[model samples]
Target chain A: MTSISIIGTGKMGSAIAEVAARAGADIQIIRRRAGAGSSLERGDAEYGLVGDQLTGELVVLAVPYEAYPSVLGHYRDRLDGKIVIDISNPIDFTTYDELLVPADSSTAVELSQALPAGARVVKAFNVNLGDTLSTGTNGTTTTTVLFAGDDPAAKIAVADLIEAAGLRAVDAGPLSRARELEAMGFLQIVLAAIGKTRYESGFALLQ
Target chain B: MTSISIIGTGKMGSAIAEVAARAGADIQIIRRRAGAGSSLERGDAEYGLVGDQLTGELVVLAVPYEAYPSVLGHYRDRLDGKIVIDISNPIDFTTYDELLVPADSSTAVELSQALPAGARVVKAFNVNLGDTLSTGTNGTTTTTVLFAGDDPAAKIAVADLIEAAGLRAVDAGPLSRARELEAMGFLQIVLAAIGKTRYESGFALLQ
Candidate 1:
């Protein structure tokens, strides 16, 4: 079984953890403090601390965009040589009309630059909502999970995980394409908040 | 019948004209010069000049983003009190990696600021590819036409035309929301170019 470590026990983190566990991955949950109850407890997953030694081949940063800097700073050394998957959408909450990152950059790109030299950063799962990710489908079609990373092997690994979890994986070129992926996420979130498609909607590319 | 004037004889202009013509709208094709051949002539549409007096209730600007300054400058008076639909995605083709407009602004919003005071600018059809707009469907699902504008009446008029053309019109809140719509357009265009999804694809919000 594939080993996966997920940080943060928020809605997105818990949802992704559930999906990974159901996919039969060896799941590990890392929390800020020990004994903190998590939704992962119901599954056969182990718990660890933020400062614990990393064991999983892939580590998912499921925290918000703002918390990335602090979280990476806390575990920078341990994350070396690990494939890091960024699922944060850096949306501006105050205005809710714009993204917090610069136009040319994305949360994934910025996180990649800040991480240790050996870590590989891949962007995935940002486009799907928590509820949608848990279900892996939006009624009729499978939820499309678009991912971007510089490493081909790393992308394939992420894509395999997505497929095993019952979702479709679309490789959106190199890591530079993360800007567009985050933009798509921002638009989807805004549309949902305004009651256009509600939060239950997912994007399907009809050919 | 709803009268519609399409400026510029490009692929988008001609495709929209075909859709409007099929929908039983009284269509007029406005070129830079009179008697200039247009694909729209293949349909039951009249040809006119850019300097000609504007008679249509709705004028669709299907020109490139770079041509908007020159075209809008020449016909500023004629476009007054007319509903202008911006279908240009101000993408930075030089890089094909980012949008040319400022992070806080969009092509539609910028065009609205430069237009005559009474002219209403609604961002529509920018998210749909020209071929997709012409067909109004991508294999299984009806193509969604997402429109955003400050004036409720103007948005409804555009939405009605979209529905009449056999597409689904999604109201994405006010004019400020055009930023997100354009971002969506930019992402879709880039995805098509990279072979992630062919240009034949259309966005479907699966509930």
Candidate 2:
């Protein structure tokens, strides 16, 4: 059984949690800021505050790109040795006109640099919209999660988590390839914003 | 009936020619340098050398980004009042590490500026691999062509050609959206180069 710790309570985080639940993994939700007092029992998933010690071998950073510095700072040395899943599309949200990361790099690469040396960064879920993941399908096409990482073992583990949820998982080369994935995400966002496409529709890897 | 004159008879040009054939459109294949004397006939499609006068209402630039200068110069005024379809990826093939175009503009935008004032430039087919377009299928999923352009009539003309070929055509907003589409093409190409994906597989937009 896999143990997963996800930080963030937004739509993306909630969407990923559904996958962990379906996998029967031990789910831990670490909020960036504790929500108002409705913290009663919500299924078998555990809840923790931002600075709380991470309890899962796999830590998913489901928050926005803007929250990375603060969240990564909170974890600091604690993230070492844990597989960190960075699912962020580091676009400047105010205008959404451009990506905030270096033109040559991606949010996943940036997260890898900021994390503790031993932490492995697996890039996934950034290419997907929350509604598609939650619905588990883009109409007839099943949601496929494209993940990339430098560590083979870490990639296998992340793929297992995603596959256990009955969704497809594609290996999109190495972590550096996240640059392309972020661009795909950016395109999806802008298309939806301009009403060219829908949040329910996204870039699907089809064989 | 719609008529399409394609500049460049490489794999990309051949693929678009197939689309026009299916659309029942009159097709013209223009070779950069006249091919060896093997030119007998290719169905109803006509063949021409570079400097030959273009006869179709729609001129498809199926050549690579590298040949743009010479090809464009050859057909400079000939492209006037034509719907010019640019399907080039603008990738630096020497090292597939980067897209040759600027951060803010796409090959379509550049072609628009370079062509005569009445020419309409539409960006399409660059996101697809030659294999996928040629085969008309990526295993189970059918090919979906995403096109962007400033001209509504041009986009519709290109979409009709694609749909007539039994593939889906998606309108990806205005010409500026070509930047995102080019990024999508870059990712697909690099992924294929690294063995992460296949030339027979590509980015499919699911409902």
Candidate 3:
């Protein structure tokens, strides 16, 4: 079974943990402090300290875009040679209309730049909503988990986890393509806010 | 039948004319010169000069993002009280990695600002690829035509045209949401370049 470590205990983080746990993966939820009640209530997962040794091969950074630097700083030493997944959409919350990142860059690319040399950053789950992640489907269609990474092996590993969780995994090419993925995610959020899809919709690439 | 006028005779413009023709709309194709052989070969569309008097209630600016200023400049006097649809995606073609428009604005919003006071600019068909617009489907699934405009009546008119073309019409709220739609279109183009969807795929908002 693929072991997974999820950082952050927000709705998205908890939802990812739930899905990963349901997929029979050995799940560990990492919080800033063990006493924090924000950790998910899933029985298959155990809460761990952020600075401790991460037992899972895959570590998912499910925190908001702003918290990335602090979280990465706190766990910098432990993240070397680990496969890190970035699911944060760098949206400008003030207006909720535009992306907060640079016009040519993405949250995943920025995170990848700040990571330790060996940390392989893969962009995933940013496109999938928390509701879809928890339920694994949007209405009659299965939710698609689009991921992008520089490492082929790392992308395959992430794809394996997504497939295990009863979702379709789409490889969206190199890590540079994270910009596009994040843009799509931003669009979906705006669409939801505007009552186009009611926040219940997930993006599907029609064949 | 909903009468429609299409500006420009490129792939996108021609495809829109074809779809409109297929849907039984009274289609008129506008070219810089009436003798230009580049106009759509469809038997249903009547060819006309760009500076000529347009008869359709709805006019589609299917030109490139760069040509918007010139096209709108020449037709600025004639566009008063007309429903103008902006289908241009302001993508930075040099890099094909980022949008050329301002971060907070969109092509439609920019064009609206440049149009005559009474010309209602609606953002539609910018998210749909030319292939999907031509065929009206990515596979068995109908392609979604997401549109946004500040005017309620204008959006409904554009939606009617989209539905008449046998595609799904999704109202994505006011004109401000065009930024998101254009961003989504840029992402789709990038996805195609990266071989994620092969340019044959269209985005669908699955419930």
Best by TM-score: 1
lDDT of 3 by residue, A1-207 (tens): 789998878888888897787678898888866777454667778778778778889999878888877887888767888999999899989987668888677888888888888999999988887888888876566777888899988999899888888988888778987877887888788777766664566677654
Error of 2 at A27 (Å): 1.7
The predicted structure with the larger lDDT, 1 or 3, is 1
TM per prediction: 0.90, 0.86, 0.85
Residue A128 of candidate 2: its Cα lDDT? Answer: 90
The complex in candidate 2 yields a DockQ of 0.50
Error of 1 at B124 (Å): 1.1
The runs of at least 3 residues in candidate 3 whose Cα sits more than 4 Å from the true structure, single-residue gaps closed, are: A18-24, A32-39, A92-94, A138-140, A164-166, A193-195, A198-200, B18-25, B33-39, B92-95, B102-104, B138-140, B164-166, B193-195, B198-200
**Models sorted by TM-score, best on top:** 1, 2, 3
lDDT of 1 by residue, B1-207 (tens): 588998889889988887787677888888976666544565477778887776679999988999888887788777889999999899989988677788778898998999888999999988888887888776567778888999888998888888888888888778887877887788788778877667777566654
lDDT of prediction 1 = 0.82
Worst ten in a row by lDDT for model 3 chain A: A198-207
TM-score of 3: 0.85
Give every collision pair in model 3: A138-B207
Which window of 10 residues has the lowest lDDT sum in candidate 2 chain A? A33-42
Say which prediction, candidate 2 or candidate 3, comes out ahead on TM-score.
2
Cα RMSD, model 3: 3.2
